[model samples]
Target chain A: MSSALPHLLVLGGARSGKSRFAQGRAEVLTGKLVYLATAQAFDDEMRQRIELHRADRSPRWSTVEAPLDLAEAITAYSTPETVVLVDCLTLWASNLMLAERDTATATEGLARSLSTARGPVILVANEVGLGIVPDNALARRFRDVAGRINQEMAAVVEEAVIMYAGLPLTLKSKG
Target chain B: MSSALPHLLVLGGARSGKSRFAQGRAEVLTGKLVYLATAQAFDDEMRQRIELHRADRSPRWSTVEAPLDLAEAITAYSTPETVVLVDCLTLWASNLMLAERDTATATEGLARSLSTARGPVILVANEVGLGIVPDNALARRFRDVAGRINQEMAAVVEEAVIMYAGLPLTLKSKG
Candidate 1:
């Protein structure tokens, strides 16, 4: 294990193995693992997916469902010895987009939370650009918002990984 | 008004009239108004502030508060005749940062949201760098995150405004 530990950003398309990759990284960092899940089981398929994820984890891992307050959750749960795995941000952004009264409120909240994260955080996100632009205005907007979110995350993170077909590609890194 | 309407981005220290300035721009865009507020007031102060903003709006203007889905909000609301004003992104970033489990999640969510916004989305963000570096790990991270958020927002935004002492300085502009 490298003595100098840094945050990790793993990006991939849907059904990609980014989550599994992040989980592996977390185990390497610490045994006291914290899984920060951003998805809410709004429907049956989602619930099943959540259940599968739950079943996959060992009882040793502590999981927290933080739909919006990521920074606070990290601060509240993480320690230098703790390894945090945030399953996905795309879903969280989608949830906020669905529920928030406005864009500014969500954006500001995200900015505030990121500035204060406490320990090593592994973030999982989607690569939305590879897909064709959606026909509807709302769909296109989701792509646009997701793109901006990715750019901001990449700017701050120490390392960025792009995963494709279950294969990981390191896009940027600082040692 | 000039055929080339200014795409103004009003930024300032918190409570430093950034929202008010953005509101003024909204007023100027009257008859063609869209107010995109990014705040989800979980506390009394924020709730009251939201209440005041609601009361302040002209009945003709359509209002939408999208916390995370900016692309959807902007596309859903934007029109050639419509002038979309996103009150603040700093808070949105903060919210995402706080709510997500780790930096990667926060960063990814943020990047996606910002890049997707459409129309004349006048953004508001906090300038967090003029002060001293935060003493602890969290504050320092927050500063770094906020700074990067601003930098990325400025890069994509057609125009950028920095408000200090209630003064608006045009940093970069397309018009």
Candidate 2:
């Protein structure tokens, strides 16, 4: 019955082990594992980060790079015998906002896709609003959007967990 | 009995409403309120931020500034009829590290002080270990030390709560 869990949302602050926890949860499922990465390698540092993340995953898991159009990617990759893991939603939101795309519409579409997904889906997002308010307008705006996105995704998921110091605290569970 | 609640350790990411939650929690106690601020106004922006925080607090609450000697400040200010709220320990840890003080020793002193405080104390701390690993050594070291301090303080406090997006989730409680 552990494998019968549906959609899960993992939320945490930076370096909070949200991704690692989500990966571990996905690994427990009995199906094809798909890692849908949203981070774009825009610089040398980011390239190295992407490489490091890639090295951490098992070779058996299929990797899909979807910096934008995440809803479509989820729809395309998810199957009845698959577990699709979206490593993050914040990066995807950033990509949308930076590209002048409508984030609310995009988020709604993603929610629609997740609602009908045939297999278990795990989503990871950063909890970025817990710190001091950013000094600049752009950063503050980013925090608001990212926070809204997390709330939306958390509302859609059947289970929501907040990761902290390598610990997972379940906020909601519908297994 | 709400007023009888003892020590509390509030943890959250930046701007995660930790300070606000701590202030609200402290207000509920039937005692003289004291706000122990640890931030050093090193620049104009910081000064402005500090001023804003000061304005948000009630006039009934007395403010105390302690950037490095948190244990001493806590010991000096706490009384049976006073509720002392330390805005943060992370900044205090950073100040100690920057000043070349022994953080472990300082943390130990803080634990000892809180163990015998005369009144209820509310301590705020940042959860800095959630996101991606920092790119530099100093940042990495700071994250490690801040996380360790949080763990130590959480162990000492009678209650520990993690603030997320303006909500307080109790991690531990003895009341």
Candidate 3:
């Protein structure tokens, strides 16, 4: 039986191997691989981290940088013969909030895009609400947004998995 | 039909409601409730936090502050007629590390104590490894140790749960 689903939401904490798990799921599909990156390299450390991620992908995979306008990027890249992997919604949410964009509108747009996407779509998001209540308002707001987005995505996705210590625990699955 | 377990390990991120869930679990047990707090009040903020936690518990519940000698405290307080709730091992781990106490030994001792404890014991720990790798060595080490201790606790506990968005997902259960 194939483990791939038309739409999959992979949730985990940082270094929870969510991206790697998403990549592995995408690799199982028989189609062109498209990586939609939401992270922006604003510092040297980030630049190096991004570079490492880029280096890990096979040359056959095409990359799309979508710090914002994630829905549009998904619409532009998704095809019946293409597997689109959005390697995180948490960063996208942060970007939208930082840009002062209405998150509800953005989230709705992304949801609509996912509903209409032509091929398999794998979305990754960090599980940020599992830690202690952040001491700052900004961090708390970020956590709330992230948690809300994860729930929204989980509701729409055909499959949902939580990664723990590099292991995947299926939270939901399509029959 | 009962959700409470004799030895439950509750793991979650900040504000993920792990502590609340643990408290609820403890409340359901039919015994004298005892709270074993591992957090240290090194500053005014922490003192306030401790006070708040203390205020949240029922006046009938006895509270024990054990920052370093957790195993000894657990041994001393746990009895057949008492339900001991340890509201976090992560802080205890930090305390042990900061005090230059041998973590491996302390962890082993704690495990032994849990194994032999007479009453029901509930542990709460932060799932710290689900995020991006910390930039500094100290943070990275803390994350590593926290993860290891969580795993160790999960192994010995009768039940293991990961709390997210105030919901508990059981990872392990007594068979």
Candidate 4:
């Protein structure tokens, strides 16, 4: 139970039930539920996953297809009355890393946007640090970079929830 | 001359006069010029470059260090009385990419910020696509990402400029 609208960061490993847990949390918040989707359907399985997610939502939930410029979408659609749910930051991060691998520019932009979010934000991110070191330079770099981002976001956001075995554990409760 | 303050994007290779050209545009705009810097010195050469830039600024200008969270910094500092000059979006992009390598998240965030600028913005970016493909995966990825970010920015901005040999040429200008 938190007083006032607070930005939330939800962290978990793959299939760790983070997405399921985020939906449960988002349903509790007031105002319209808006999903800021960052994943693009590259293959059939991904496309079906996206569709299933879409089908799971009630008509009240507004879905914004923001593969890029998610902060802007959040700003545009989010109000004090709007609860913004960004599912899975890992995919978003991957999209950016792979898309803009030459220049390290996307993370700062996200930090700037997160700092200025107009309404409550529920962000979903994957924990990528517990695994073994990558064998290659690029993979190794990605892991390191993702780890740093998670650390920074966890530091700034109001609260962070880590999910495992389909259970939610409060990591930090700034709220 | 455009009635609406032209949103300019200045692109150039390293040491190819992109920053200088951007500064010149800022000088022509009405009201105060806001210089948003994104570079942090990691070495002696960088420190020297920073000093040179500092020395080059006019007393009337205001400078702000915004290595991360540029969108938030821009919203906080810029006004209609200001001609917001983002000294180098490439640096900000690079910072974000380096911090997390989450290109989609960062790119989306920046796109949102650029779309809702409070005043005229003169953005500086590097033309990374013109160079040879990087030998390493990270370098190649970075070049690709930088190119996408630049295209995204240029698409929404009112005017676009590319600098060569320290000379500014209007690549996409309205009015």
Candidate 5:
């Protein structure tokens, strides 16, 4: 099921406009749009925001919840005639931690899935390791996990970029 | 004491190689290099590490401790024959908060100083806002201050880059 289409990995800090930029990139491509959401609504406000976001992308896209098991979701939802956009791996990494799933193994699986993706797959993630080291062990661990995921995913993707203040800084573009 | 040389802004996360990259950029330019250090050694281990870092840059560079009053330090140290490199603004911001200095006003002063720098000035700062929002109010405030500083510096500098894993991703390069 592997295809030659490029897979993109977009990494950025909070409010860096990574998700919107990624969606715009996905929209410009040919095929049915499939959005793989890895974020979970933890409260009523979050749920409302999520619902509003889904509504915003509703008519032009179909949303698939994959807070966990993202690799499987990518493998199942991607097709030659589809454009799959995964609007974040940071939360997914957290979910893996909470579920006691080994992030290193999961990252390897995700990379493999991306390698065999039948369509153009765009992944968005928060670059959370840039801030000061956290005081808590859990946050520090999460930072390490998230950073490791980004470095690994970035290596696998055909293109990678860091978004800042709504600007794209290309890290790599496989020619 | 303003010169026409373009100042550069280098931003990145921890271990993202921003300082080394900025140093390399500064070393490539013609000048007497001066390093403005903003970090303080609280413990003996940190003292040893700071000493090691200083020794690593010795023979070719002079170091000045500017834990606070960074704008004043830049103004005092910069000259047409010098290339001043501020290893980081993240620590500087923290130092300001610890001392109860007005970060916004200090930032304005820094920007003004950079604009009228007597020679080439290369600023290194952590892109700390890219990660998960900090849980502590103080950490959150620090993140916001650092982010604001970066945004302002990015706009002022003629060259701006985000270093990642020792690689430079150019955000803005003046034409």
Candidate 6:
């Protein structure tokens, strides 16, 4: 982790093509491609979603499931020869809530890991706070957690983008 | 109606400071400020929200309640000496749905009004599709409607921006 590479944070709403855009960026970089997926199949809907995402990726990428311990996954998988793409932080935030883990600690750990990452790391997150407030307490809490995570990761990364209808809007460009 | 000034579309999530930013822009323009408010007080919470928003503006802004017939209101209020600010369109979209109005026709009417408006226009809207799929069908339909309205308004406007925590990211710039 001596030589730190610039990290990128990709954010968008549902079906905004953020994951595809991040994958395209990762494919253009030179390294062993690694995908650290944070989604767990708790139901049939989620299972189907996971399979669809898996099918969307090419054979050049190896997958790792890190539903709760995402920070540790990043720390372990990041290498000078590897390019790790964490295909979302939103689900990871929800997973933390479901598992009753401390999110602040986890968020800090994740940010710290990115600061010393040996290879280029690309993170994807859903921008969930742009809509009307949810009726349920849990959903609102999830939105706050997800949004805070996005902000922290964006501050840690060298590049940040928000996607709309497959269009990338530069939020924080690496100078 | 002729001599149309360039229109602006401001988009953001809840508490993203879109309203304040749009108001600042309108205050800088030279004209009598007109606020086309689309929000209706259906309950105590909504009534309080409306009052708070009303208190946010100065006496320079004359408010017009246009919960449904926004296009007609724009046609009546826009003039060479006026700067019109439509506080929001998401609620207008909902109002259209609740009133059983044809959204496609309404959207077209709005677009046409902007084409030949006689004053500078600033429109605000919520970006509601960035979260997880709502569990209910009506909410899903609303997301689609609101997203479509935003996309259309964005295409028609000379300036388009998305607000995040009071920071504006330019989607399109007036040339």
Q: Which candidate number would show the highest DockQ if scored against the true structure?
A: 5
Report model 6's interface C-alpha RMSD after superposition on the true interface residues: 3.5
The per-residue C-alpha lDDT of model 5 at residue B121 equals 90
Candidate 2 stretches greater than 4 Å from native: A1-125, A128-168, A172-175, B1-3
List where candidate 6 sits over 4 angstroms from the true fold: A1-10, A15-126, A129-160, A164-167, A171-175, B1-5
DockQ of each: 0.02, 0.13, 0.16, 0.01, 0.26, 0.21
How much does candidate 1 score in TM-score? 0.48
Q: What is the DockQ ranking, best to worst?
A: 5, 6, 3, 2, 1, 4
Displacement of the residue A55 alpha carbon in candidate 5, Å: 0.7
Report how far residue A109 has shifted in candidate 6, in Å.
21
Q: What tens digits encode model 6's per-residue C-alpha lDDT throughout A1-175?
A: 2234478899988655689889988887777899999999988768987998999998999999999888889889999888899978999999999999999999999998887677889999988886668889999999889989998999888889988645579889767
Model 4 stretches astray by more than 4 angstroms: A1-175, B1-3
TM-score of chain A of each: 0.89, 0.96, 0.96, 0.88, 0.94, 0.96
Worst 10 residues of 6 chain B by lDDT: B1-10
> Mind listing the fnat for each candidate?
0.00, 0.16, 0.24, 0.00, 0.42, 0.35
**Which is better, 1 or 5, measured by lDDT?**
5
Residues B1-175 of candidate 5: C-alpha lDDT, one tens digit per residue: 1244479899888656677778887777676999999989987755975887787674679999999989999999999989999978988998899999999999999999987778889899987775566678888888888889989989999999877645688889867
Candidate 6 per-residue C-alpha lDDT over B1-175 given as tens digits, one digit per residue, 9 for 90 to 100: 1234479888888899999999988887777999999999999999999999999998899999999888888889999888889989999999999999999899999988887778888999887787666997688778768876887787788888889899998888766
Top-scoring candidate (TM-score): 2
Candidate 3 DockQ category?
A: incorrect
lDDT of candidate 4 over A1-175, digit per residue (tens): 1246577898865444677678778887767888889889998757987998789777878888877676677677767777888876667766777777422355566666777777788888877665445566876676666676677778878899765324456889974
- Give each model a TM-score: 0.48, 0.61, 0.59, 0.49, 0.60, 0.60
The weakest ten consecutive residues by lDDT in model 5 chain B span B1-10
Query: What are the runs in model 3 whose C-alpha is more than 4 Å off?
Result: A1-125, A129-175, B1-4, B55-60
Which residue pairs does candidate 6 place in steric collision? A130-B13
State in Å the error of residue A66, model 1.
1.1
lDDT of each: 0.68, 0.84, 0.84, 0.73, 0.84, 0.86
